[model samples]
Target: MPNHVAVNPRDHKDLRILEERSEGMGDATMCCITFPEEFRNLQNHYTILFQLDQEREAFNCLAMFGLENGENLFLDNGRWDASYVPLAMDIQPFMIGRPSDHDADRKVVIDSDSPRIGKGEGRRIFDDNGIPTAYLESISNKLSHLDGGYRASSEYIDCLKKYDLLEPLSIDVTMKDGAKNRLVGFHVIHEERLNKLSAEGLAELQSKGYLMPSYMALASLSNLSKLIARKEAAAINV
Candidate 1:
């Protein structure tokens, strides 16, 4: 858990956050919550897939980092291998929070306990005049975009569910060193069913911008080969 507090220029005018993308600074995770808006960039380097969150009873886009659990293959020598990093990953210790007292109030909250947050030698969140810096404004905009993207992503997932276009996926692979990896429990877009949809159904998806994200996800399947090659390279170097 992170210790979060509302960010205010009056009290935290000198807040500085570490901007370096380094391991142990919070990028060690094997997967991250992604969205349809991110599918295009994600397809270039990472496998884009939808995962069901049983607790929330909704689907979220996930960008996979490794074949199995806890192994982040994209972390090469403490550096991320991809040219495009997801916004969810870029948001870092700052997150959008809605106050319970106010129904529609959205505010920026920072994890004061995060190692990234420090007093010296980092990106300043506010200027000496207590105005938000360009970097801070960018983070605020990204978080706001993410908030809206998630709502649309949920509706898109519901559409796929309504048409029964999502199917369970399982993949079994044999690594070069005779290690077996069996990945299961993730849901994938049903390409066969997708192709056989009615004209009206196709039009609905196309009009809503859902069609492109679906194809982007299917295209990401080719990245499995890239994942395997990276795994092989890691194994060889070991």
Candidate 2:
């Protein structure tokens, strides 16, 4: 469990965050939650898909990084190979929080238990004057965007559901070494249904700026082949 506390410059003056990409910092994952706002950039490097969120009882978008559990092909050594890291992945050990449900204002919160939390050899969150540093400012921006994107995701999912645009996706990969892997329990945009959508529906989606993201999700499937290629290369090196 995460020990989250509201960020305060006075209390966390000496706090710093290690920004390196590695499994120890929790980067070893198959996928990360993504948002439509980032689909354009993510489509270029990741296979964007949707999965059923039983808790939310709705679909959640994802940016796939590997074929199986605890495998992030994008994390090469200490670097992330992708050009655009999902906000969910980039904003580590920090999150947006509300004081209470009645309170509409949001504030920054930090995970005190995260491996990234450190006092030495990392980026400082606050400077000598107890003011937020440039890195902290960037993190705040990412958190804000992530918060907004999370809220907007519901509306996007509703639109796709209304249009009956989601379809189950199952991928089977056979590596050169005769090992097999299967990716299941995910969904993708039904291109056929999207193509058959009524003109009124199309206009409505366009007006709400949901059409491009729908297309972006469809385009992202192209990267699945690239991901598989990377997996094969990793196997060869191993």
Candidate 3:
């Protein structure tokens, strides 16, 4: 479990966070939450998919990095091989928090127990004068983007649902060694339905600024082949 606390200069002035990408730093996940706003960038390198959040009874967007658990094909030689890392993955050890459900103000919270927490060997969160550092400022921007994106994503999903534009996706992959892998329990934009939508429907989606993201999600499927190639190469090296 994460021990998250509101960040304050008094108690967290010495805090430093490692920014390297590695399995040891909790970057081994196969996917991370993403939003439609990021679809344009994510589609270039990741397969964007929608996953059901059973607890919340809602669907959340995801940027797929690998086919299996604990496998992140984008992590190469201690560096991420993508131009745009999803804000959710980039804002590690930091999150937006509110004092109450109705609170309008948000606070930056840190996961004190995260592996990224460093012993004065990484990016300092604050300077000697108790001011946030440039690294921390960047993180704050990422957190804000993620926080706002999360809320906006819910509305996007609702719009998709209203138009019945989502469908289940099941992918099966065969490795060079004849090993089989199956990706299940995820959804994707229904391209056929989207193509068949009426003009009014299209206009509505366009007016709401969802038309392009819908196409972006569909286009991201092209990266699945790239993902499989990476998996095959990794297997050969191992």
Candidate 4:
């Protein structure tokens, strides 16, 4: 299903260009809908409609489809507007749910054939296989209240340094969004000691986008911070 083209029957009639009815609104218009690479993995086709006002106001209408069997699938309305990064944060339900005292052994599995997570839900489930074969109604019900966002602060870095798990890396910042003053920095790990880094060490790196494992693999050897310091010292003739 590389490219799909659909015709709108309502707008198929040809009107004379000289007529007043055709003067304001053009008769034939074609819309090319392109999907970003990230969304290619989505199994089902989705349609989104967006409306914007003069004051930069925006609203969205999600298309809800009703199948002959009375099943429903809500298509994302933002598909035509901006690219989105799909995010899935691991959940621990005990903390968020009351009591926070569920035994570690208690766990639940959601299968695609399960009625609660019907066939056409919003959050689809993919087997370790190449294709997504299941759908889940909600991740919230299965979630345990384990708060999991742990960013590596400077103190955490100090601890990692004590274990020799962290070393100084290069910094390269990209300024792409001037309006937001957003800066993306890269901290490259040296190839010699990278294999020694463990899952816990990688978790610390995950706190900063720049420290992603792929960046470690492709980062330059030269340390930008050290180079700046050396340049300053030489300028002062120290």
lDDT (tens digit, per residue) of candidate 2 on 1-238: 9999988988999998998899999899999988999999899999999999899798999999999999999988888998789999999889988776755778899989999987687999899999999999999999999888988999999999998899999989999999999999999999998989999999989999999999999999999999999999999999
| Residue 218 local lDDT, model 1 | 90
lDDT of 1 by residue, 39-97 (tens): 98899998877788999988888988888777778776656778987888788889888
Superior by TM-score: candidate 3 or candidate 4: 3
C-alpha local distance difference test of each model: 0.86, 0.92, 0.92, 0.27
lDDT of 4 by residue, 208-232 (tens): 4324422322331222333233334
TM-scores for all candidates: the values are 0.93, 0.97, 0.97, 0.23
- lDDT tens digits, residues 1-238, model 3? 9999999999999988888999989999999998888899889899999999999999999999999889999998878998888889988979998777665678899989999999978999899999999989998888888888888999899989998999999999998899999999999999999999989889988998899999999999999999999999999888
What is the overall TM-score of model 4 with all chains considered together? 0.23
Better of 3 and 4 by lDDT: 3
**Candidate 2: worst 10 consecutive residues by lDDT?**
97-106
Better structure of 1 and 2 per lDDT = 2
In model 1, the runs with Cα more than 4 Å from the true position are none
